[model samples]
Target: MIAAVRVRGRTGVKKGIQDTMSMLKLTRINHLVLLHEDPTYKGMLVKAKDYITWGEIDEETITQIITKRGKLSGNVNVTEEYIKENTDFSSIEELAKAVVAGEATVEDAGIKPVFRLHPPRKGYEATKQSFKEGGSLGNRGNINELVAKMI
Candidate 1:
């Protein structure tokens, strides 16, 4: 799965990018969403690259995110028992490992897919330029560090 966070605010955003961001379920800055890596989602990401940062998420980081921010229907915090009761996996670690291995999905386990994150502790490098230009926007390759800061 790919992890993406909205890095920029809504002011002055183009309507197309705003629509794409909305489709990605990122309606606010610092909001995060996990997406399956596919051409369709990739196209959307490309369209909103200037307002978000995305990258492949590692298993360890996925586990951390699930353990720390995974939620369920009715806004319940995800717990080991909850996972065990609702899915084949007995624990969050198992679920996360399975997701990373492409054997399971959050939907299959009935967990909420969106994660609302805090702004990164130190803020972003730059939001107006692409990552290639030393900004935090665009594909980050590995977003564990950035996700950690927000978490």
Candidate 2:
């Protein structure tokens, strides 16, 4: 899956990109959405790259995120029993593993796909430029380290 975090606020942004970001569910700064890496989502990411940072995430980070930040419908906390009752998996760890392994998706498990995270502990390196330019926007390859900091 892809982990996308909105890095910038909605100031001086075009309406088109704003719509794209909203469609990706990145409506606020520091909001994270776990999306499947499909071509349509890829195109949308490119369109909203100026406002967010996205990348491939691994199993460990996914587990930590689910355990710490995941919630169910109506703002309920995710628990081992919840996972067992709502999904085939018996635990959150297993659900996270399936998600990272591409065997299941956030939607499939009935968890809210959005992960509202605090800003990274020390903040982003820079938000004005792309990741390749030493900033925090755009595709960041494997972003497990960054995700950990946010978690």
Candidate 3:
């Protein structure tokens, strides 16, 4: 799955970019959303590249995010019991695998689509620049380390 995190706030942002971020479910800074790597999402990512960072995420990182930050409806934390009771998966790891393989989604496992993440421990690089320029925006090839810091 592709992981996208909103790094910047809405101040002075264009209506079009704000709408794109909203559609991606990245409505606030440090919020995360996992999406399939499809053309539609790619286009949205490109359009909102100045305000968010995205990259391919591995199963391990996904598992960590779910265990540490995943939440269900009514503000409950996601547990193995919840997964077993609500979805076909018996555990969070299985659910993560299914999600990565595109067989399921976090919502399918009863977790909320949006993950509220803490800011990276040491903070972002340069919010105004792209990842290629050592900033925190745009596509970042592997975001495991960044997600690790946030979690």
- Give the lowest summed-lDDT range of ten residues in model 1: 110-119
Q: What C-alpha lDDT does candidate 1 achieve relative to the native structure?
A: 0.90
Query: lDDT tens digits, residues 1-151, model 1?
Result: 8999999999999999999999999999998888888999999999999899999998888888888888888988888998888789988889988988778888788877788888889888999999899999999899999999999
**Number of the predicted model whose TM-score against the real structure is largest:** 3
* Count of residue pairs whose backbone atoms collide, per candidate: 0, 0, 0
Question: How does each model score on TM-score?
Answer: 0.94, 0.95, 0.98
Error of 1 at 102 (Å): 2.5
Residue-wise lDDT of candidate 2 within 73-120, one digit each (tens)? 999877778888878998877877888778998778888888999889
Regions of model 3 farther than 4 Å from truth: none
Instruction: Give candidate 1 misplaced runs (Cα > 4 Å).
Output: none
The residue-by-residue lDDT of candidate 3 on 3-65, one tens digit each, is 999999989999999999999999999999999989999999999999999999999999999
lDDT of each: 0.90, 0.90, 0.93
Clashes of 1: 0
